[model samples]
Target: MKPPTVFMGEMTNREVEAFLVDHQTVIVPTGSTEQHGPHGPLLTDVFVPQEVARRVAPRVGALVAPSINYGLSYPHVGFTGVVNLRIPTFMAVVEDVAASLATAGFTRIVFLNGHYDNTYAIAYACANAADRLPAGVRAFPINYWDGMTADEAGEFFGPTTGLHANRGETSAVMAINPDLVDLDHANAELPPFPAVTNAPAVHTAFFFSTPGSVHRASQSGTWGDAREASVAYGERYLSVVADATVRMLDDVERTFGAMPAR
Candidate 1:
């Protein structure tokens, strides 16, 4: 039998409503256009999640929404090519998107996020939108990496695992888009941070643009070793993350039924 078609941006109105009517779950790919060390692509943050969504949407019989390629990346501004949305602006955009989908009758809206900085903002947007949505219309935001188990983490990043451009991320990108990676420039380095820090670290919208203190702290903006990254390992990691995400969505659907009639 043929696989269920995942809707893309080019889908017609009838096709969209049909998919919604048949499968209430809609997956939205969220990522950032930021620097990812010397070898990885600037869009690495978005590419992984997008690829995962593309692979899983068909299996779960869900429609794929156009990706929100920009995210909150103020911390990586100094590295160049890193574009980020202000916290408030990002929150507003997410809220508006969720509200619009809820209004259109999508009961289960799943946000498949790739960027770490957008986590808090996305969470806030989901909560705020849920409050405004009619009963049963649930908006869920998930950090893809958070779905990984400790065992999986260990498997991906043995010991040296820094937050920014870590081994797991580099490996995943290499597996997904090997051509984009410039192995010659790949370097492993981790920046030092204070023992304690508060949320939002810095409030400036463009603090990532600073050198030394910003992304340059790491020689190549890479936090972990990329030498261990392999295509096979990446495929396994992607499968595990996608499976966990599907299970989470199933749990959410069971917890919240269809939306109430207007």
Candidate 2:
């Protein structure tokens, strides 16, 4: 038999009401619409999390909510097609979604994040939204990549995997949708980290100082090698993402109690 439609957008209102009768957990995919080098599409951040959510939804028997496509991309502001939401705006968006889910009877709102820059914004939004959530409702924000070790991630995408438009992410996009990647034109460029101390002033100057923006640090809009990215590697990485997400969902269920009989 075919798998049931787990996407919230694909289900009817009545279907959702009925779904909530058995399932009290909802997975929200949070991502960004920004430049992902020349090889990766602008929607790379958005698509990766959504795909990962879809893969794990069935295992957890949870509904995958409509994704929050735009996120805080201030670091990539100077890049073309990069639309960065202000911190407040991004926080509001996440809070609103979590509130909506809780109001709709979801006991647990799990946000699967893909954008590295959205880390603190998501955490702050969830913490602030806790008071707004009804009793028994809680929000959990997490990144799918966090399941893997830093060394493992670096191995797949090169050492600069933490940066934007790297090999691992490009390979993931390739695995999900080969048509979106232009491997032939892919470039490898790792911007130099500032030679300053561990002081906040130096760090702020590098990221917040418009004179040394992301574009200025890396001219090709890429941070690591994408030329070596391959569909096979992407498939492996995506499988890892799916497995890791499912493991996390398992933990959530264990911590929150399976479905809660809502």
Residue 235, model 2: Cα distance from true site in angstroms? 0.6
Separately for all candidates shown, the number of backbone clashes (residues 3 or more apart, or on different chains) is: 4, 0
Task: List the candidate 1 regions with Cα displacement exceeding 4 Å.
Answer: 1-4, 157-159, 193-216, 254-262
The per-prediction CA RMSD against the true structure, in angstroms, equals 4.4, 3.7
Model 1 TM: 0.83
TM-scores of the candidates are: 0.83, 0.88
Question: What pairs collide in candidate 1?
Answer: 77-208, 77-209, 78-208, 78-209
Judge candidate 1 at residue 219 and give its lDDT. Answer: 53
Per-residue lDDT of model 1, residues 164-222, tens digit only: 55666777777897787777777777655445444245423324434234564555677
Backbone clashes, candidate 2: 0
- Cα-lDDT of candidate 1: 0.74
lDDT of 2 by residue, 1-262 (tens): 5345989998888888999999888999999988889889998988999999999888887899999999877878777888888889999999999999999999989899998678878999999999999997879888887766666666765435535777788999999989999988998888777566664576466766453277777888898888888889888888988887787767766867855566
